[model samples]
Target: MVDVMHQEVVALENRRRLYTGLAVVLLIAVVMSGYHEASQLNSGGFLQGLAKFFDYPAQIVAQSWEDGWAFWALFPKFLPALIETLNIAAVATIIGALIATVLSLLSSRNLEVPAAMIPVVRRIMDVMRAFPELIIALFLIFVLGASPVPAAIAVAFHTSGALGKLFSEVNENIDVKPLEGLKATGSTWLQRVRFGVLPQVLPNYSSYFLLRFEINVRASAILGFVGAGGIGSELSRAIGWGAGNEIAALFLLLFLSIVAIDQLSSYLRRHFVGAESFG
Candidate 1:
């Protein structure tokens, strides 16, 4: 009994040590990834390539606002624009979800494929996901002429790559029984996917779409800085002129909108997940 107890204690210690090592490695990986992204986003070469409207700190501080209360006055004006920003987010997410769903079945690991072409397709998806959405917006603004259309296209592409990847992962993890049953009944590959895959993943798909919409809401609000229309344009304009109150109101509205979204997304997620019942 004494020997068994000692061995159990040793095994527990080893498991704890292994978990600690894994946690440390994961933390390091996350930090490195964030640093790499920041470096890429701020690269001078990238800025030059995009020809983004530039801001100079010196020019900004040259303007004046003496009263703190003046900043608070600007929020009310941003309300309508904020709603427009949320609409852009919703519109982008809906369009992107449809585009991505089609791509996802093509990308799913479990899907029957022409063995040689899967990698080619996946690489295309990877390229789309690798660059930031803002970069896509920049290009769209260039080609599409800086309207909300460009902004929506940018969000759609970003969401497609991301949500497709997630959907593919979900596809891979689903129980094989339903899929096998379909195949057993002489179902074509497409039919197998239609019946087997869609049911299991719809909850997760909706959840991801909602999350993307939340991000897009924030993204749309700022797309205007690059001439892609949204409330972000006005907010950026106010900030440029040292209209601190307007900026504050815009930011506060953003905070409230995001908070509301966070709650709504949580409720929807739980409802879909069956953790909470929806009436």
Candidate 2:
């Protein structure tokens, strides 16, 4: 019996090794075929694009070096555009967080609600998250005549869905004792949620909101490229005119703003949510 068991174990190990090897081979084959197809479809072959990738950056740097004085001059010219982009992100994040709060509570299982409504609200959130912000912004730009307002609304719509799902997940894990105590007092649903749930989850919610704000700032810039109204629009114009010197300046400003925002949000998240949460 001992000999038979040892043989069976060896056979099982062999089969496991075989299966793992087959899986690795299949994955490699798939990756290679996908890369080949992509290269075939690309306007420039993969190797060709890779070789020329540094050419544009080299030109921009050379131009900026030659006309470095214009770099400082362009900063004031574009300051308002940067402010507009930040405004769009800030407004969108706030609006999205507010909407998410209501949806999250309604969708949370621990919270009291009509059973049918839960799936309805969840589906709405699903639809919201499924649409990309860029597509929404383009559609809105067509309707609303290309302003920051449309970009804000588009970003907020997507943010609401994204944050609502996260908020609901946070709600699911909160302490229940306070909620039970609130209910025992015959407290209203809103009262119970306000006093019981909000305190426990607010840190997590705020952390997520701050992260979303960082993302929306970048998204707002991209939306401006499509005619939304921000530094992106100005950047687009510079590119169209082949103003490499101006492009370098705009790039520098954008890069600095993004890094500053990232650091600030990271610090705030660590302070509010605890470092372990991010880890």
Candidate 3:
């Protein structure tokens, strides 16, 4: 009986290995095929362009070094644009979190939402998340005539859907005792959630909101590339005019700004999540 069981285990192990090997091979083949197709569709082939990929960056860096003063000079010129990008991100995050808070409660199974409406609301969030922020920004830019307004709207729309899904999951893990206690006191649904659910999930919600703000900051800058009015638009124009020095300067500023925001957000998230875990 022991011999028979040992052989069966070996066979199962062999079959698992066989399946894993096949999956890996299939994944590699798919990746290669996708790369080949992308290269063919691209204006420049991958291998051909790969060699020159660093040429632009190299040139920009050398030019920046040669004219370091000019690089510093561009900061004052672009300060307002950077501020605009930050403002866009802040406003969008606030708006998105506000909307998401409501949607999350409605979508959460633990809440008292109508069963039939849950799927409908979830689908709406899915639609919002499905569309890329860039696509939304461009569409809004066409309608709104190219301003930070469109960028903010695009980021907010996506953020609400994304955060709503996360917030619902957080709601699922919350203690039901508070909710029941509130209900026994004749509290309305909204009152129960506000007094019970909000306290439990606020830290998690805040952590997500800060993360989204970091992402929206980057998105806002990218949206500016499409003429949404921010540093990105200026960077696009500078590149278009072949202003290598200015491009380098803008790149430096962008890099620094992103790093600063990333560090600050990371610190806040750690604190918030840590506090929630302790509580």
Candidate 4:
């Protein structure tokens, strides 16, 4: 009996290894074929493009170095645009976080007031998340013309869906005792969620909100390239004119701003939500 059982285990192990090897081979074949097709479709091959990828950056650096003083001066000149980008990101994140809070509560199985609507609400969020911010910005810009308002709205729309999904997951893990206690006291649904649920989830919500804000900052800048009105628009113009020094300055500004926001948000998340939740 022992010999029979050992043989069965060995057979199963061999089958597992065989399946894994086949899967790996299939994955490699798919990757190689896809790469080959892409290289054929492109005017320039991957290796050829890769070789000259740094040429533009090298030129920008050389020019910026030659005009180091002007590159530094561009900071103050572009400060207003940077501020505009920050404002758009801040407004979008705040609006998105608020909407996400409500959507999350409604979709959470444990906290949902009308359980029947949970699926509907989840589908709505899924649709919202399916659309990228850039696509939404383009459509809005067509209707609204070039402006920061459209960019803010686009970011907020995407943010709501992204944060709603996360917030719902957080909602699912909360203790239900507080909600039950609140319900026993004749608290309304809204009251229960506000008093019972919000207190427990606010830390996680805030952490996610801060992270989304950092993402929105980058998104807003990118949207600006499409006439959404921000530092991205300025950067686009600089690139169009082939002003290497100006391009370098804008890149530097964007890099520094992103780093600063990332550092600040990381610290805030760690301090408020604990180190484990920082990610």
The best candidate in terms of TM-score: 4
Q: How accurate is candidate 4 locally (lDDT)?
A: 0.94
lDDT of 1 by residue, 39-142 (tens): 68784744464565434433333322444465555666677778777777888889878878877777766777666666776777787689777888998777
Q: Which regions in candidate 3 have their CA more than 4 angstroms from the true location?
A: 1-48, 274-279
Error of 3 at 22 (Å): 5.9
Write the number of the candidate with greater lDDT, choosing between 2 and 3: 2
Q: Write the per-residue lDDT of candidate 4 for residues 77-157, one digit (tens) a residue.
A: 999999999999999999999999888988999985687899999999999899999999999999999999999999999
Instruction: State residue 243's C-alpha deviation in candidate 4, in Å.
Output: 1.1
**Candidate 2 wrongly placed segments (more than 4 Å):** 2-6, 30-44, 274-279
Give one digit per residue, the lDDT tens place, for model 2 in 189-266: 889999999999999998999999999999999999999999999999999999998898888899999999999998
The TM-scores of all predictions, comma-separated, are: 0.72, 0.90, 0.87, 0.91
lDDT of 4 at 277: 52
C-alpha RMSD for every candidate: 9.2, 2.3, 3.2, 2.2
Which number leads on lDDT?
Answer: 4
Better of 3 and 4 by lDDT: 4
Residue 167 accuracy (lDDT) in model 3: 91
Clashing pairs in 2: none
